[model samples]
Target: MKQDSTLVFIPSNLIYKQTGYLKGCKKCFENSEVYYVTSNKPIRNTYQYQCIGFVGETVDFKDSIGNIPLFINSKNGQLSVENNSSITQILYDYDRFKNSDLIHNQSEKYGQHFKYLSEKLKTTREISQNGRNSITKYILFLVQIFDYILKITRRIHQIVQKSSTFAHFEGNITTAKWFLTTLMEERKITPKVGNTICAKIIDLVIGVILTTYLFEYEQQIFDFINFNTEVIISNLRGLLLYLMGQPIGLKLNYSYNNFLGRFFLYHISLWRIFLQGLYPLFTGYFKFLVLPGFLGFSYQIAMISDVVSIATFHSYCIYIYAARLFNLQLKCLKSLWRVLIGRKFNPLRDRVDSCQYSQDQLFIGTLSFTILFFLLPTTMMYYVVFTVFRLITLTVYKCLHIVRNTMQTIPIYLLFLWIVNASSMAGNIHIAWKSFDDRGNVKIEAKLEKLPLLESVKKFIPESESPAKNPRGFGEIFHSILTGTIL
Candidate 1:
């Protein structure tokens, strides 16, 4: 019988070990049979075997070689044998067949692994986008809340100002007390009510709490915007330092005033004694009459002193409050500027560099105007104080003419008044300067533009015009009414 050609098929497994033999197998044999080999290597487990054709005819040497059939039968009840027709061709085919199952299996496994990884990456991206959207929504909500609070405060201020009569004051105080008591009750704290003084104390307490909440809310909004705790903390420290410096400067001015007042009193007392000794000799026992005149003169001086003191105190208080308000305004402006420009701490350079047209002129114009406003007002006030001091000195000399006997003592009253006014002025100036340094004007400008009613008011009143001066007495009165306690 004619021998049939051997055929071979290489399994994927063991492909790497048989690259040279694979080339030989394709060249030497037209058709050859092949079988894949298994190994203990972990990587080889996913591979499988393949057969191209029959290897050879079955060979049964009963006692010796027939054990192959038995071995196959023992394992899986199947016969396993190679053809014998083309022995030489079959041997070559078997030697040259390449195993490729390992490469195929590895490719499929990695493809699945990459597919899972891609899915996870897409999911992560979606979660991040959602978080960003939520943050944006939260910021918008905070801005709305801020707007509402501003409107409420403005309305309250107007109402308080319009109703200034004693009855109105008492009514407001009563309302404040009720509001505070209700708030306390809501918090499960016992409520207390008393006279005007007590009410003011409560008002102060409530105001402080409200202020704290406002600050906390602002901080949260800031955190959302920046999203870095260290940056937020640094900015907060700057704000706190600016605030702390205000009271220190105020106290220093107060101390200076007291020293001046004491110096004036000492000189004045000496002058009085000297004048009394001189007066008796001028009109024989008229010195006794001069005592009564001295007493009346002292009363007039006391009244003048009281008026000056009260006015100075009121002015100083207003200045301090205005300074504080200005500081807060500047901080807000800085925040807004950062939002608009997409940069922080480079207001001048960044803003200016971005300017492309005349529309951008507004920033420079506003900055120039602010600087002028602050400098002009401060300069005018300084000159005015200087003129006032000159006039007071002239008045003191005129008073000395009538009471030449007490000429030495008149300087004491003048000095006391001068000291009080000077101290108060110094304190106010310090506060205003600090506030300006803190960039308050920028904030106020931003707020005025943002707020609806405020913007309307600004339209009617030019930007050059200042707001009505706040009453100094109102702080103490309001504090007492709100908190129900006296300081």
Candidate 2:
């Protein structure tokens, strides 16, 4: 199947009954042909019929599709898999299961765009409808079972305390807030770790691993990419400057050269396959890594926080998380946002039209141009600088016997960093803000409250009234302080 057209296995009898079916059918199809799969002939004249097959529960196909199972359900009228959700629907529901490999690959490989997902499903379907084995079938079965078990537990808990957040008031922001708070409080304790220690441990492990691995080989990684790609990076920058109307003979400043030199050297594609792939792989987990660190580090503060502190911290966390998501969405919305916000009615319309618009464009274009020329040389350079700086300082201290041993030095610094972070310096530079954000709300303090009046007041207060200030230039953008709806 070269995908000359769409492959539809519509019910044979209804093909001729064109109830905008043709429209949905035609738009998707690359070619005019529609393959029909049915057990019986059409009741009326068929538009196109190429395949004949019976789709039932115990039956399997010979076509070599991907290992994932696909089945047609006559009962629900869904193209489903293993009696779960519809195949088409699940494929459409990106990130429903964040841990899923298929979902992860969708973002990394295909940018998780609708067109890409749709095309992928179409191609995979037409490629081959190979029958999967009992092994895959069993694994899916277990997943479904676990999902069912979780759902049942949640449902049971819902009965004890109402599932609805604001049970009386249908749906609103207040209701949503209450419900979410309830959910977090309801199951505050879990089997393995009390106080969400698992999240903390994970953060510690990842931080240690990142620090050690990156610190040790930082120079090596830098040099390897730099020495090999220097000429190409230089020549490429010169070319870019020329294209931008800058003379080729113009002397480049250290800043300009540094910026260009780092771009290509940071790229993963130029490296051995395994290494390059790791960058995005690491990036995609940015939130995961960050959240754990923030939550874990600030965990104790949360337990002791007063009404205002608690409300602010929780609300801020949600805001930051949501902002992070918004940022991610913004990345995807580039060209799309330009057209959308260009509309006068759009919320960000003014921001879109401002003089900063060109600056933003230039910034994006420059960054893209850098990436286009070379992968991530700038990123690697920054990382190596940090690593070297930390290592050199530690080395000097140790050589002077001021820092006696690795165990004493590292732990002492780490603890000092923790204290500094917990003391609110974390809210400044270096993602210690993440740790600070995790300080739990003491207002709730393991108690479930129906009306968090104080929290509500805390939520609505103007930013100017709040004494807290973030030095980070982009803090306002990332730190969300929702006005109301505190629970």
Candidate 3:
């Protein structure tokens, strides 16, 4: 009872139609090759009249020819793996889950941005109105100095990424790898940690040199600062004067408008005096004052930015006052309108509910609504103007910080490691064709290989967070305009 040596091909649908039976017949054999599973005992010369192979789920195959579980093509030299539908379905479901996670992460990022904006708004208002005491001033100075150092360190990385020398070094990395591989293996030194340590050292040296250069030209920086400050004060004076009149072709409350405009102008006069008093101090040892023992030039530039922010504190104060008034009036008008409609908002239920109002309540609501409606245009105009000014300031700083972060966080060191020793950061291996059979048939062998440099780089560099969030998006701004909410 030796097993048959012949292996044959047959359509899976034909075998399935037999209901798990091994029957040899003209109908089953027509246009199909006879197939049988066999043990390697001997080849058969006579055709077996009955089917000779296991049938049904045990010998599973696709219903179609193109999707056969295993096949060899003379035209192509590829070996395709079994394509199970269940596995494909599982992959599809996983992709769908990842898509949902992407959306959830986006919303979470938006919330974080909104929170950041709100905090900045509150801090700006506080600084503008209450003014910074000596302790607060020192604290602000220390924080800004630390931020400057961080930015400079990031800038060093930027310099490295842009260097022609580094690019050339990357080109000869293959040679370097061959020379250093033996030593590196003996020392158990991996490229990942080596790249990081080298990058840090480079950044430190370059940052120190750059800061020293900037310090040497301190006088020129002070001159530029003085010129910019003068120009800003002059432009601000003109802007205040323009706002005091009917500047934008719209009729505003003349008395209130002029009062706010003149008050800020006087405040600006006081600021000019305050700045002049501190001018000599900045030109002298302001660096030491800002960062007790450190004398970095980036700190000076940051201190200059802080000074500009202080110079515009009066405008922020005006924005706060106008925005608050506009928001308060809008809220009052909304409540009164609800009362007129015989509805009130239930905070607990988070929805509007029917309500009954007395005659006095109705009268007061109506009167208040009418007054707020009339006064809205004046408050809105002030709020819009100040908001524009506030946005301009925010945009400038936003751009500056974006540059700093880009310099700081880009995976240049990992990328450099990828260039020099890609295997050090490799995460996985893939199979690739290694050789062909001597018979010149469609048969081949594959060898396992590490991921390529680009793919390995992805494994080493962690995924970055979403882009920088804005204080308000265009849709939110548009909605606020329609609803009369504070922007």
User: How close is each model in CA RMSD to the real structure?
Assistant: 35.4, 30.1, 20.3
TM-score for each of the candidates: 0.14, 0.16, 0.52
Query: In candidate 2, which residue ranges exceed 4 Å CA deviation?
Result: 1-3, 7-53, 56-197, 200-468, 474-487
Question: Residue 105 of model 3: what lDDT?
Answer: 20
Residue 434 lDDT, candidate 3, scale 0-100: 31
Prediction-by-prediction clash tally: 43, 25, 0
Tell me how far the alpha carbon of residue 289 in candidate 1 is from the true structure, in angstroms, after superposition. Answer: 38
* lDDT tens digits, residue span 80-136, model 3: 223311110000111112111011122341233222322322232212224335545
Q: Please give the CA lDDT of all the candidate structures.
A: 0.31, 0.31, 0.48
- Please give me the total number of clashing residue pairs in predicted model 1: 43
Order of models, best lDDT first: 3, 2, 1
Candidate 3 at 173: error in angstroms? 32
How far in Å is the alpha carbon of 343 misplaced in model 1? 18
